[model samples]
Target chain A: MSSIVSRNLKIYFRDKSAVFFSLLGILITVGLYFLFLGDTYTDGLADFNHPEIFMAGWIMSGLLSITSVTTTMGAFGTMVQDKEKKIYKDFYCSPIKRSVLTMGYIISSAVVGLIMTAVVLVITVVYLAANEAIVISAMLVVKMILLSALTSLSNTAMALFIVSLINSEKAFSAISGVMSALIGFLTGIYIPVGNLDEGVQMVVKCFPTSHSAVLFRQILMENSLNEGVKSYPAAAQAEALAEVKDVLGVVFKFGETECSAEMSLLILVGALVVFSSLSIFTLNRKKTA
Target chain B: MNKIVQVTSLKKSYKDVHAVKGLDFYVEEGKLFAFLGPNGAGKSTTIDMICTYLRPDSGKILLDGSEVGKNDDEIRRKIGIVFQDSVLDPILTVRENVTIRGSMYGLHGKELKEAVENACEVVGMTDFMKRPYGKLSGGQRRRVDIARALVNTPKILFLDEPTTGLDPQTRVNVWNTISDLQKQNNMTIFLTTHYMEEASDADYVVVIDDGKIAAKGTPAQLKEKYAGNYLYIVPKNKDSLLNTLKKNKITYKQNIDTISIPIVHTVDSLEILDKVRENIDSFEVIKGTMDDAFIGITGKEIRR
Candidate 1:
């Protein structure tokens, strides 16, 4: 495992384009956030108390999801390149196990996600502190970083599953693009899901991205459970609180308008495990086929 | 000699086309066996199946007396394949490629390093160890690939058209490297090529034509059986030479300016030589070559 990780790291370091794109994602997210909120701040700090300002932070979190998609796109495309060059044949014929190859690719993708997440987190925290909107605690920062990593794992697994099914690069790009667009639009990354038709909202809610984006928004925009739940209205807020209680069970007491951080984290972790298992199963089946 | 590899009734079809018909052959241990065929003659398909890259539709492959299809991993561990196309990573250096291949065979640390060094030395690639594989010339890249396969110290090696696109000098170099490896390691080699000269040097040769075994024997035996000893003549006046041979009842086969007749007796040779002396420009009495045998047996040109 260490050897695999070291080899992946070495390859990653040699890829200047990959490093540049990672930094590009970070810069784009920071630049867009500051551009929109630059005029609103009195001095150098953001006003997190304002409803519009808080919503803007949520929008920034949704945009960060694009980075997750981009990371997977690059990693999966590299896999295709390896196949074209017959480099995969060398590894396949070796004594190395198939599981190791799958895990190595997934872990390397997760590492890239972690790096991008850290960049976004550091810039957001420093920017928020400078604007005097809110102070971030070390514990909250740790939780946010862990959530980011989980989100990355889930996205990478999804990409791996797609790659296992298809061998052509053009087909991979087309399918991954359609998937990213659908997930992004359904999760309200570009347009608010609540503003859509009632039927559309119902359809979007069934998607994992809808739940994931909601959880991420809760973390980045509102630090407290009460503030997180206040984004919705009476009936929806009550339903969210009930779902949180069901997930928490014996962990925490559920108030009239409150969400549970531990419950959201559990859902993310579960989704990651299921997607990763599916990806591995698909890869094994393809190998025999 | 003990048989090291046996392929029985091996068959593979691609959609509507049968790439490899029911084929059977065996390789003896420590022998250099050559598979000779033209383009699209199923040579690559056979190699691919034996290397476990492609599964056969119906057949049994035994390597060292163990069934290969049933024990693919073990069989693969004992065999190394150098594909017609380059398979080395362009981003990696020659040394890194060798080390990674060695590690794949469960070697590591000092053992892996020494194994990689030995493989490089055999392929004469030690001086270019640190160079990026992509930076090297085509022949150099091919040498790196050979070293990569040898790093595992496999019991059997497969070379698929190993010298196919190389210049004459580079081809000689590659062949020399292969010869040295065979002698130094006592390795069993299975090679495929279209060059008749290349096949002539093998310990055993199998000629495949249209997905079937057209002929199989040592170079000397094949020449003796399919190609009979003959006297060749290139006459200056083709019409007069043909008239004389036909009028004299001389049994001969004519192809353009060349005419060949079987050696029946030395008594008739002086009479025939004198009769054609004025009309003929060149004449030779020599043994038949492998090319002649191929043409005689297959009844088709060995198109590249």
Candidate 2:
């Protein structure tokens, strides 16, 4: 299985175009936010001294989350291409277990997701600092590191579930395009959850990745949120923060139940368990020609 | 002879189509076995089941005395297959492809490297082992695939139409490789091909069609049993040819392209041609062959 994992990693890296194209998804997302969407978003959050950093933090976290997804989806392309070319026939008939093959895909995809996300994190931190935004503390930095690992893991699991149902590299590319585009809307990076209608906001809160994005906003935006409210009267500031928290998915709502940050973390964990099991179950039934 | 494989009452179906109805055959140790059939004749389906890639509807298959579906991993460890289509990773070098296949068989460290090297040496692919698989010619590509399969040191090597599309020279190259592997390593080979001439070298031949065995025997035995020497004549006027042969009481069979008269006497060959000379466009004394045996047994053309 380790051999299979290493083989997948080698194949993915050897195809320089595939690595570039996979990162292309997140790169395009960043370009769109900067060239067209960033100033529009910054202008709305004028109450803060560095609304640019506040918006950058929110968008950058969303970029990291979606980068894990598209990159991992690219990693699974090796598996899909093998199936397409009938290379799996040799592997399937060999003295190797199907579970081992599945593990190969999962492990390689997790590694790619984490590596690319780390690159995105570094650039983001440097960019925010250059703009004289609120600095990231060592404690928040530690939390981001842990969250980066978890986000990659969950995204790999989720990608595996989606990829197992697909059998062609062409179909994978088409679906990845749709998924990459939907990421911005779902994460509320394009439009704040506060600006959206109640119905649309509910949809955002329901997605597991949106919960991850909300976690980043709570921590990275913590200082900016506090700074925005310092000039308000005490009573008005408290009420406004409460409303902001609910609207921005800082606390997810299930009909009448408002979920805390710890509950959202539980959702990420649940997604990991559910998607991993689902992918494995589906892969066991997969028939190779 | 020791039986390397024993199959009984094997059957398989895909939805409404029954690909293999009932299959039963055994391969002997250190010999080449041929599964011969035309396209859509269930040749691949039977091979797939025998290699444990597909499950049979109901059957008992034993590889080296272990039940196939029951002892899958054990059987897999003992057998290796070269698929009809090349299955190597195009971007990967020959060494990487071979080593990965070796690792699946539990080879590691020095043992794995040695196996890959030995297999490449066996297939004469050592010079090109560093090249990417996609860059090799059709013949070289297949040799690399053979090396990858050989790295496992399997007891029985299954070649699924191993030389189907190569040029005559390259086809001979692959066959020579197989023959040498069998002689030196004493590896048992079970191959499937529709080419009758290719199966001539096989020790045992099983002809399958419409999900059943059409015929089975040694190539020589089949020729003796189903076909006999005959004189072939292509006549322009069928009625005149039939009348001439019938009036002379010559035993013959009428086919689409030619009329064939059994050659009971070697000296009578010229006389038979002489009798049909007036009505015939061409004539020849056709020696019986494995192809004729196949046509005789199946009552259908072997080649499409």
| Top candidate, metric lDDT | 2
Score candidate 2 by DockQ: 0.74
Q: Write down the C-alpha DockQ for each prediction.
A: 0.43, 0.74
Per-residue lDDT of model 1, residues B134-218, tens digit only: 8999789888888888888888889999999999899888888887777778899999998788888889999998888999999
Instruction: For candidate 1, write residues A1-289 as lDDT tens digits.
Output: 5555555655655677755553454344446545763343313222122444444455556655556655665556556666666667767766677778767777776776666666666766675556443457887677667667777776666666667777876786676556644655565554455445667655654444445566666665554334445656756876664443232121122234333656656656766777778877877787786
Q: Give the per-residue lDDT digits (tens) of candidate 2, residues B1-304.
A: 9999998999999999999999988889999899888889998888888888889999899999888789989988988888999998888999999998899999999999999999999999999988999999999999998898789899999999999889989999999999898888899999998778778889899988789998899998878677778888889999898998899998899899899889854467888777777787987776678888888887878873
TM-score of chain A of each: 0.71, 0.91
Which residue segments of model 2 deviate by more than 4 Å?
Answer: A134-137, A167-170, A224-259, A284-289, B232-248, B252-260, B264-284
- Encode model 2's per-residue lDDT on A48-93: one tens digit a residue: 4566766776777677667888889899998898889978878878
Clashing pairs in 2: none
Q: What is the TM-score of chain A in candidate 1?
A: 0.71
